[model samples]
Target: MSRLFRDVEGGPLCPQGSVVCIGAFDGLHLGHRALVRHAVARAQALGVPAVAVSFEPLPREFFGKAAPPPRLTLPRAKVEGLLALGVDHVGLLRFNARLAAISAEQFVREVLIARLQACEVWVGPEFRFGKGRAGDIATLQALGVELGYTADEIAPVLLDSERVSSTRIRAALSAGDFANAARLLGRPYAIGGHVIHGQHLGRTLGFPTANLRFGGKVPALSGIYATRVHGVGARAWPSVSSFGTRPTVDGVEPLLEAHLFDFDGDLYGRRIEVEFVAKLRDEEKFPDLPTLVAQMHRDATEARRLLMNEQQRATA
Candidate 1:
């Protein structure tokens, strides 16, 4: 089991020594995976633990809360992905005013040296941190020399002649290109959360839904999508999902509403993963409830057809 730490002031997460990889890791894209894998390999060679460090609220999000960039993965998904990548320790440092004010030297001395006892560090080619974003690979290397550690940056992972990055993945998703996004992510792009109670509006419209809140973070994609829900049965259930604030209903917060075809069970309070198969259309407001219901009927029909074809192709 991977141990998780949430603050730099905590006791040593890896006392002996750790090979650490540090980044925002918003999406855990192919490039991010390559860097973490390098850290894991180095840790094994050095016979130490592998540690993955990330920041919650991301630096950009903390600074730009009024209009933060769309997030590819939530905090829970990020931790799960890091653990699945074989890290022995995961640190999700809180990115607040105090942390943002720390200088590069202090970050290295306190967090990397004192808390993690890092013997080696790995980062991506474009990684930067510290106040004014002053830290770079060179900065880490310089500090590593004095701090009894080593540092290196990994080359970006490339797919189809383009470098894999969170930005590219977001662009693909926004453009409704799930295949391209999957190639960059090394897996399907999915959102996981516990189903929460809603106003039961979908049920009245003849389309009951399992709703998941976005937790105030900007979502990477917002649309009607063909999806599959996992964690309920022996197989993934086909679904049509809508992610957006319900403008027609005067809704304020972003919510993901998934309507599982032919499913008739309580999903409230259940955790599930909604995997994107294809984007059907952009979220839009209908003039009235009847119009919205009519549009939903068409969406369900199209989503069902797409999902059936997708399953056939997968089995073939």
Candidate 2:
């Protein structure tokens, strides 16, 4: 009955049969949404639950030891995003050494066949899985004949003739091209998480902030951003946010700190989403406290100006 799961060795989750889609699904962007929604439609027609199978500590992340690479979405956000797309169940399979050693055939037999009892399986183009990333659409189709299921690969979603992909989104984010990123993602770029206590350095500097941590994952983008915080009230509150380690304070952990304008409330333990509107500046270390505080004031003023303009245009 649980909507979320994190392991591959569990008992059957969809005993009655299900439609399954598999992907990394880090960003839950247009392509991922399309694949998941398609599988959900198939499940509805078949009167079975829809299951989305993805991996935590994604294969690439696991294998890329030189540098783990940046992540656009974390585990929690990935699950919530998939569920919001109408997937009845989510499998954020733990991708450790054990899971990595299993053959593609073993994966399909254990996860797709035995666990999910999938009657129909869907995936994005060029989808691959299993040890050494050996599985592919051909592998799935061939296995489907032997395992009593059907396999399919959805056409790659495209924008302006280029494939809409997580790679593309990451590039846009790196360039601070959020408008293009939003176009590919099908929504504004935002990160949602429960607020946690920080060093209270912002408060000490007279710019109190609500902080969110990145759970040790490297973020795709970092810097000062003009943003809007959602879920506190009727509307998205105007805010300025910084996503990065506070080098100026000798901080090591990556954190997202938002300073909501003209707002006074406790956000600790409250989950909220911060939507990025524009990149104000890159996070940098200042010489001293006074200089850092002065820059913070300027950054805040710039953020306010940007958000107000955005609000005016939205209402217009």
lDDT of all predictions: 0.92, 0.91
Per-residue CA lDDT of model 2 for 241-289, tens digit only, reads 9999889889898899999999988899999999989999999999899
Task: Give the range where candidate 2 is weakest over 10 consecutive residues by summed lDDT.
Answer: 1-10
Model 2 segments more than 4 A misplaced: none
Tens-place lDDT per residue, model 1, 64-169, is 9889999999999999999998999999999999999999999999999999999998998778889999999999999999989999898878888878889999
- After superposition, the stretches of candidate 1 with alpha carbons farther than 4 Å from their true spots are none
RMSD of 1: 1.0
lDDT of model 1, residue 289 = 93
lDDT of 2 at 125: 89
